[model samples]
Target chain A: MPNCRTVVPFSGTPEQEQKLREVIARYKGTQGPLMPILHEAQDIYGYLPEEVQATISEELDIPLAEIYGVSTFYSRFSLNPKGEVKVSVCLGTACYVKGAADVLAEVEAQLGCKAGSVTSDGKFSIDADRCVGACGLAPIMIVNGDVYGHMTVDRVAGILDSYRGEVE
Target chain B: MSENMINLKIDGVSVEVPAGSTVLQAALAAGVRIPTLCYMKDANELGSCRICVVEIKGGRGLAAACVYPAADGMEVFTNTEKVRASRRQTLELILSNHRMECPTCERNGDCELRRLAADMGIDSIRYEVEDLEPQLDESAPHLVRDNSKCILCRRCVAVCRKNQQVGVISAADRGFATHIESAFGRGLGEVSCVYCGQCVAACPTGALTLKRSIDAVRAAIDDPSKHVVVVPAPAVRVGLGDRFGMPVGESVQGKMVAALRRLGFDKVFDVDWAADVTIMEEGTELVGRIKAGEKMPMFTSCCPGWIKYMEHYHADMLDNLSSCRSPQQMMGGLVKTYYAEREGIAPEDIVVVSIMPCTAKKFEVSREEQRLENGCMPVDYSLTTRELSDMIAGAGIMFGLLPDEAFDPVLGDSTGAAVIFGASGGVMEAALRTAAVVLAGDDADVPLVFEDVRGMEGVKEAEYEVGGVKLRTCTVSGLANAEKVIRAMEAGEAAYDFIEVMACPGGCVNGAGQPMHSPFERMMTDVKGERAAGLYALDDSMPRRRSHENPEVKALYAEYLGEPCGHKAHHILHTEYVPRDTYNV
Candidate 1:
């Protein structure tokens, strides 16, 4: 009964499709190619849509169920498109013990979007990562590529305000 | 012992098994019991569920008996203190997350997990299940999926991908969120699921089960205005007895008829009669196609699973399929049309229910093409063998002691060719038996038995010269074998004049709607072979061995329909197909 929490509309362009097909053709015959092809497709499309999964299923002759299974198994692969400003809160053991869940909750309230989904305006997204390997900076939050160590609930809105003004 | 045998000591008993055998196999060889939850012989061996964990001497911890190989001088202890605790702990953890509604579960009495828990004497669950919110999926016509009862064994997934080769269902997501689902969380009906129900059969718990029609059938029977007529498919005759405490491979045709009569049906008939009629129409079509050289191979359309698979996967070769309705649908159409007229009952007033060994028949009965011109389906309710057995038990009818009763004379009589339609090569063999005589002009010598296409092999191929016509034929059970044949034909490596495909292994006798057996019994016993043998035995006992020889079928053709494949017969007994997308959602 596990289902997709949020599914963004598939907006892959013709150029992106052509690039995906090329990537599929390059790795069609390689042993265990679904993983590599999925990774590349995710990179090209920013996320794996049902339409993109169907294309891969047809080109590789693999069942779409299997492709979807592999895509969902790895946390690296995203099913929904990431927003322009991606916010990731590490919920690994170290981060959780130091109150990362509060940070994640604040982000969700500020962005008006749940974890693993984009905001209504498609400008902000939040995800709970397992571990970012920064235990020394427990309770860490990453915005785009920039990491904030020892993050607090009160500081979450201030950091988002700084990016909100820049994006608008 | 053979040179390749491995020496092992299981529970202090010296056992010698094949080198490639696992610790479970070695223990079984030495008469040791090792309970398993996620192990289905030749189908699933994930060892994900550690219910089969056993202690090995000189090893650090308990190892899974299903995957742990038996080596020379290996000491395997199946029931040691450590093994017992580990298995008990594993079961407890699985049960912690699993929905414990055994009283109302479909597989209450036959559940493997429940049986194991009782055997291990686990009275209570220590941990509470975090709200998983496992949803019930009743999207498909044939199967219902309840993730609440799923133990994440993946047996259904393995069987779907490996045994059936359909691969419609798979384990999506990971960890606690992992659940079996179709692509993109689409419903099974929304996807290209053929509704074969093999996954239902592979499920160890109440996670998967056929969509029941027992209540609808009961309602139709209770309505005084309606006249309900029941027709059981050929395979049900041989497979239904398995639920009645009868021995496996026992054909209780008379008892089945008696039970249906006791179930308040207005008439109890046999689908085998319609199977004979199918041979007449399909045989004529096959001969015409061969004579005109229209298509290379004419695939049989009796199996709804195979039909849907063709429609989904091999739509381009749809023309290659014989347009004849399956025996069940043929019988239903005839009951609503010919029998209804004969009895002076309106087609709308008469309810046609098919008792089948297949779950796919439920979907088949709901098809738009199967509906009459009056906008009513020929078959009202298609009930599985298991459903019928449950209804019989629920009605307080002692099936074992019921007197053997013959089917009503209206649509009861059939020939030997009709009975064998339960097996894999049955339809092909039945067609050949009649086609030989049709091509050679009836009174000419023809072979009654086509031994080449008989037995329980996944795929069988044969070449025969009938009436100076050299015909290459292929008979396949299991969609995987069908896929292989199609791929071979596409590659120009193989050619055939006729092909018969049954999606279930060993044909309808091993259908998903038939009796459920434990993994041990399934691995040890040849259920498919035994059930098919029962049909073949019944076929051998019949005096008339061919379809054309069925007196009732010939009487119908002479009385109403002018001839086989005639315009009127075509209107009722034939149908068309359309291509379907695999991912319709």
Candidate 2:
């Protein structure tokens, strides 16, 4: 499966709302459409807010609880808005064995944010991953899709500084 | 042997089963026990657990007996070494991820997983257990969810989605991270949960249990200045003996009363008496609606689960719901006001505790609309039959040995119609007994039993004659069925003067807070049917079969209140509804 771009929150503009409506219109009647609709919805809106899910639920006639269930069940979906610089520390089995927990702690301390949460300014967000499939490069971390292999706890500070003005 | 009957052999024992029957069904019929975790017989047969796996001759791998069909001359080995090994591995995998908090768990002795583990003689886990971050959800009033105790059987999810049509919970995440939760990973109390606790009843482990009110009752009971009056629902008696070693459908109302008396309740009353009063107010409301031609189909407002479902999904039909409080709430209101005033005790001094066949009652009493002006809760603490049974045993009372005793006189008298409120179509039947008489007036001889509405069909519609007017009624139990009836009503395909809806299938007899059916009990007996029949038997044995004929209700109205649905009854027994968004978070 190709990587789906899951960043870029909705500006709450009319165009984004229309795009969301079109996504719901395209997938409403398909068999088991909630997951797909949610996937597309997350793409259209960056993350599923209560309002986005409510729109899909209204269009598809699916219960909101069910849509929420499908949305939460898949780790790929995010309920909160993503920060400009999305930092993910791979806690996959290989990474954990190679001191990924220390790397995660370093990332959180430097970015001042925990997994699944955005920083106060919303410029930096952090999360953990299962595997980036780069197990050979154990203890790998990603900042805005830029992979840093063999990451040490000490090297985390340098990585954040590298991405510091790259937000624009 | 019929032509459709297929012959099968299980461990060299020959058995004949219907052609379409599953191997599990045939084995069960042959008195063979195969353990199951995810399988809930007909309700949920997902076959995900793999605990009920059996070796099929000439098959490549082990077959899940729950879903595998039995073939003619099929040889199945259930207790073989390979089958046992596979079952053990499956259980071990489940156990590895499970929290293993059996000692302090809520469902310690009553859990299916704990029983299976003990039966298999699992001394120690062979696999590495997952170190999980414990999550506690007390969002809803009646239920608590512990993801650590969950085995991902999906039983609760299936029951919630398929049976109730209120899928407030679903299988979230995947693999080791998989656990059941509400949409968007929000707390259940934050969502549109109906607080039905069907998931709690369907759970095989302590993953789900009630938000208990035992401690509050104990505190009230220990307070010398306070008078805690207890009222048990009609269905409580039929299923109370289930947790004890007694047979299913055992009549333990008398012993239940005796047990409550010994538990230090100042007054042990019957909620059925309030059920009779419900019939008076609700029946009067039906008569008024029929006569006024307002709100074409007046729905019964008895089931809190159904009411919450309406607030979320069918808020437009709020006008159709009868404005009367449920029997539990009605009894609560009366106990704090009428009963307290009669006994010369201050309403504040009276702590009303209700023992019910529903977990939703706990949520119901706490509802803002059900509280009085001075902030005194009508029913202070609501306990399920299961909770009450546990309390009785905890107090060292020998339930079976206790002699039969009657309830205290003030609020104890109940007729047959009141008692049948525990079963599906019962409220309709009970309401009909009084409504017809009120509507018929001179020609008020209605039949004691309305057989058309008295069965286990998902939705039953019946019409009866009252004087020259015809009264159409629809009775439904499960919320799924309730949806169908509402849809039909919307489409103008059916119309009714009155409609009764019970959130649990088979009504309170199969309530979520009632004694649950273990997988063994599910196989052994028709738990709902047996309990419903016991209620009907009690209904038959009573001399007065009509709610209006209850002498106590008659005297209460004659003495305290002027008439049913009068100014005083409206203030004490009526309620309002508000529309809410399905997803709050």
Candidate 3:
């Protein structure tokens, strides 16, 4: 394996640099330590791409398989870069029974993007999860951090329209 | 009393629980039974089942009490009007897509979902029922998958992937159309699933159920011309009582035999009889192979899950597997061949039924190689411990009130060592019992119980000094642990003289044929682990547990088979494996 070093100067504030250093130092000297650091980094930066995975893998001397395994094992970890706004629909049993299927279809139709895929404009990404434990609020959707419960097919376009407007 | 206790208030009740406790645990500690469908303690906590949603003050929405961390000075209301209304609505919605055939469902009485619905007073579902059709995938011999019954709790997925480490099934598709499916929508039998039935045990509802052979067995029993024989597996003795509400680990072997008799079987025999026969054959094979230097570390061939896994992943190591039939198959073969000749009955006239703690044995019984005797499969029907209990109940036989009876002579008697095979590492221990005695040239007075290889631990290893020879042995119960053991062996990190592997955790007591529950309390501290402990206790109490001491086995070798690895034994007992695609592509 060839060792390549590329130094990228940081222009963040001292506090930000200290936080990054603290996160990096937590995974030092452990076997296959890159995943934990990458997870923490993603917690700070939102999503990890190939560049982030490679940087952490190089720093921790862990194999790609080990990092990939950890990343894939956890539901929270995202490999592909996500858009600025995240739209998650709850496909819980309640939501499913309450016609979340049509709601999801409407969201997909309006955004022109499948769940777990980013929109063409890169403004939003849609992801479907098992449950957020809010089954009482059936057919629920979360945009950015605000949850929209009791969602309908007509409501989906309006929900995404608000995000598009905010981004603009 | 000062061991880092955390005080939390649940529904106005101030409860003190140990720190690091989840809000669910605290509520449970305070005698609040928060209804949940997908929160089996330790086994699964994926929060896929939203039935246990509770109102946490200032917390984000309703939280799944099973996984959410309970903080100090937290106000948690488990059963407020808001919580009850929400839970009722959630239950109603879940029922909208679910098949409400509880009257005819196998898990009707014991189902967690049914119990929860009744407890929550959900008399009817107000939502419009969807046109969701139940997919009854019955291609596998051991189990059936009904997608309509599934709540998508991911309990089955978690147990399959994390516990068993066999990723044959997972949540496929997305949104409301999402369903748990085998890879590429292939049948489970087509996938590299070992048929251990751990997924069945983990499922909260009627989504996964054992493929029952009770009807077949009943038909055979009713056949006037056929002599129906029952072979109870090693672990069945310990768990047969759980179906009757008997305390876990209580030996219901006698009652099991009685039940079989009541169910109109001609003979009720012990599978342990053949387990002893297996030890004799496998133990002797190991010795001969070791002496000839043909193959070292001969694997036990009893667990069908381990056998199937080896057939799929380690085909090259097939030579290392002992060519000995499992006790179930051995007994089946013996009943059809040796016993048939003695009774002056045709082999076709004998209906061999095996009652086992494993669902994998259902697949094992149906295997083509198992038909070595008279061109017929040795075991005609393989029923699970739960199935046997149901049959007993169906017959209206008073299990507890019935007198304790003995197994019929010739095949009913089994040694104490054979009983342990019901748990993980039991096969290795049973083999060691015979192997060590044979290696010592005579049955020595040394303790036969290999304590190191016993327990609920995922993996156990022990090195024994037997008559100047150091024999390294290892036992792994769960599939994930089995994967770890195989990886270790491949990496040369661990070397063993023998290895025993079972596909389910805590062995056959937790097999797919066992009870299914979600939001299952901690097995160790709850009812499930108690049943497992019951199995271990039965093994400890049995007298003459060693396989060599079974008179039936001794007589079979003396009258029919010359020795353990004789030509007659080899022709009838041993089997081979076939390779499978791991990726299911």
DockQ of each: 0.55, 0.44, 0.03
B1-585, model 1: which lDDT tens digit per residue? 789988989989998899999999999999877899899988898788999998899998889999998999998888878888888888889998988788988999789989989999999877785565557999899988999989989999888888777898888988888888898777888888899999998899999988898998899999999999999999998888888889887899989999999899999989999999999999999999998999768999999999999999989999999999999888988988888888888889988999999999989988997677656688988999999989998999999998999889968999999999999999999999998887788746789999999889999999998888999999999998899999999999999999999999999999998989888887778998999999999999999989999989988998888888998788789999979877773
Clashing pairs in 2: A68-B183, A68-B184, A69-B183, A73-B173
TM-score of the second chain, each candidate in turn, equals: 0.98, 0.98, 0.95
Give the Cα error of residue B91 in candidate 3, in Å.
Answer: 1.4
RMSD values, in order shown: 2.3, 2.8, 10.5
Best by TM-score: 1
Backbone clashes in candidate 2 total 4
* Cα error, candidate 3, residue B328 (Å): 0.7
Tens digits of per-residue lDDT for model 2 on A79-150? Answer: 667788888889999999999999998888887666766766778888888888999999999988889999
Which candidate should be chosen as best, given DockQ against the real structure? 1
Local error of candidate 2 at A130, Å?
A: 7.6
Give a tens-digit lDDT track for model 2, residues B99-216: 8878888899789998998888788888989887667888888898999888888888878888888777777655656677877567888888788888898999999988888988
Q: Give one digit per residue, the lDDT tens place, for model 3 in B1-585.
A: 466998889999999999899888899788888887877777677666677889988987898888888988999999888889988998888888888788888878778788888899988889998776678888887888999999888887777777876656766545676677764345777667888888887776788888887888888878899989888876777777866777656777777777788889898888877888888888888878877878777778888888887886678888888888788888889898889999999998888888887888888888896787588789888888888888888888989988778889998787777777777777888878878888887876756778898878888989997755678888888878887887888899988888887777877766777544344444324443555566567667777878888888899999999988998998888877777645431
Query: Which stretches in model 3 have alpha-carbon errors above 4 Å?
Result: A1-168, B1-3, B517-536
Give candidate 1 misplaced runs (Cα > 4 Å).
A1-6, A102-114, A119-121, A131-168, B131-134
